[model samples]
Target: MWKKWMVCVLTLILSMPVVACEANPAPESQPAQQTLPYRIEVLADQLDVPWAMDIASDGRIFFTERPGRVRVIQSGKLLSEPLISFPAPFISEGEGGLLGLVLDPDFANNHYLYVYHTYKEGEVTFNRVLRLREANHAAQIDKVLLDKIPGSSIHNGGRIKIGLDQRLYITTGDAHEPIIAQDRASLAGKILRINLDGTIPADNPFSGSPVYSYGHRNPQGIAWHPDTGILYSSEHGQTAHDEINRIEPGANYGWPVISGEQQKEGMKSPLLQSGDTTWAPSGMTFVSKGPWKGQLLVANLRGKQLQKISLDATRPDTVLEAATLFQDEFGRLRDVVEGKDGILYLLTNNRDGRGNPREGDDKIIRLVPIQP
Candidate 1:
């Protein structure tokens, strides 16, 4: 009886599954596994080629439609009418129209807003950055500051932001002319910085000009690191090598001559390269003061995803591609910005005639990061 009992006990023990546990795992330790802690929720739909966005102090999100209207979203609903609309002369063909929008740092006091758009003058035309103030009425325009800068219907780089130094920084594309990127006299394919009143800062690299850095090809997204204060930009590559670069004053980012990491003397290589056909990156935002703090969030148009890159540990110099979310559901993500409440807001680009749209197409999505 004892031998039979022993055999049965041995068989039961052998059949049970075995689990290996670490001898001294910390009680509060998190697993090393990487995961996306956000749930993407669609806020509103039926937008047309929405390019960029700025969140107002009152939590209203204002964004631009490439065809010349600026719209707002409040409390999960899109406003019925445009806040402001430009004349037809300000809207050009392909890559032109109302492109970028930013609020003045002292907007509460000055009520100033800036915009970048393509304008026409008889036969000659150019992309111009304009500053306007809110008139006594909410939807009226008051002023224009600094207009005319050389434009093309195809490659108008229209991204503007106010830097920590209280200066406006603008990113311009190559205007489909590769050589223009290297021309010091041309504003095409360059990053520029200027004072709020539209004057070049005396501390700028180019004495009397707003040129901060040169040699870019269709740069769309610009963001500053939370800890380092260093600026990071996303560039669109022609056929290959989409890049993310760390911006420095007077530094030249190679455009037509070099795409990725070519050993050139004066050019700076991208910290990360998307390579040929994988990603066409657009607007980016850094997630600060959350579980995702220190991670760079990038919106991809062609790839149709929101990619996160962890850069807090490094000096914003290393590029580590993290979990990509919302690619299959959103169609194309154009711009991403972090809300004051720690939620991530995304602008979908499906209505731009370049993506496949479903029932709720061309929408603004809010992603709330959840605790894992």
Candidate 2:
């Protein structure tokens, strides 16, 4: 009787199929098709390297010209004069110039503004975060929130955004040193979260550190999901694999040790990974409403196009790469943002000394979805 029972149990166990729960499943994912019909339109021309841009509540578009000037565009025209310009100390060599900008949630009330740029000391040094108050047509420097963040002429990560909770978040690159990404004490290669007043949030993973997540090579883009309020970042990969990561407070993204999809024992994989050729994703924005509401719009740099990625938080593999439109028209697209009118805005980095610049190199292009 005991032998017969054992045989029956063995047979039952054999009938159950083995399931694979590995980090990287076999047969990698393929890109998806484009859902919405859209067209790209050139808005401005001959501007310097436009790094980052933000839409003001008053329906004005504010963007940075990498040579150290902030300009405004209203009603599809570039303003003759710049809004503000930093002193010589703010500009750096290659990727450093005026990089990021964000307005206070209560811009009408406080009129506070924030900027991220590489501060030079004798020669090109590291990047720093500065805050100021914006008045009628000028800005008053209030404080330097964080400084001495390792900066490289190449991989200086310069993107900042305020979350739905009103907390400030900044993304820093590895400064060309891959090992710095794994070091918790170093500010390089990490996403930092802090209070508006430059104090570290008490609930951060580490006791006194401002780092929310680590192990990033060069994270240039960050945005919050309109529905879930969860943070998402676009990180540049080394030779292959540009990533769209779903950021968690205490998570590590495994930079030097891992790139895109890793099969290691304990490494957080990317939510979506694209091959070396077709995509070099930069700034990303979530479609707030309309038919494309919940989809992610990723701006490509090398690939010279904007990719629409469908995301499913529960199943990471559900990130389908949609259309790769505007392949060569807007050379080396840098940032993709949604404006107040719900149209998408793209910043072209053609004049950045990489691609062939057309007549109006380094221009801001806007795209609107049309009904099919």
Clashes of each: 1, 0
As a TM-score, model 1 comes out at 0.86
lDDT of each: 0.77, 0.79
All candidates: CA RMSD in angstroms?
18.4, 10.1
Assess the local accuracy of residue 150 in candidate 2 as a C-alpha lDDT between 0 and 100: 89
Q: For model 1, how many clashes? A: 1
User: TM-score of every model?
Assistant: 0.86, 0.88
What is the per-residue lDDT of model 2 for residues 56-119, given as tens digits with 9 covering 90 to 100?
A: 7888788888888888888778888888887877765877888988888887788778888887
Per-residue accuracy of model 1 over 188-245 as CA lDDT, tens digit each: 8998888988888999998997778877888888999887889999888887667778
Looking at model 2, which ten-residue stretch has the lowest summed lDDT? 18-27
**Judged by TM-score, which candidate is best?**
2
Model 2's C-alpha root-mean-square deviation from the true structure amounts to 10.1
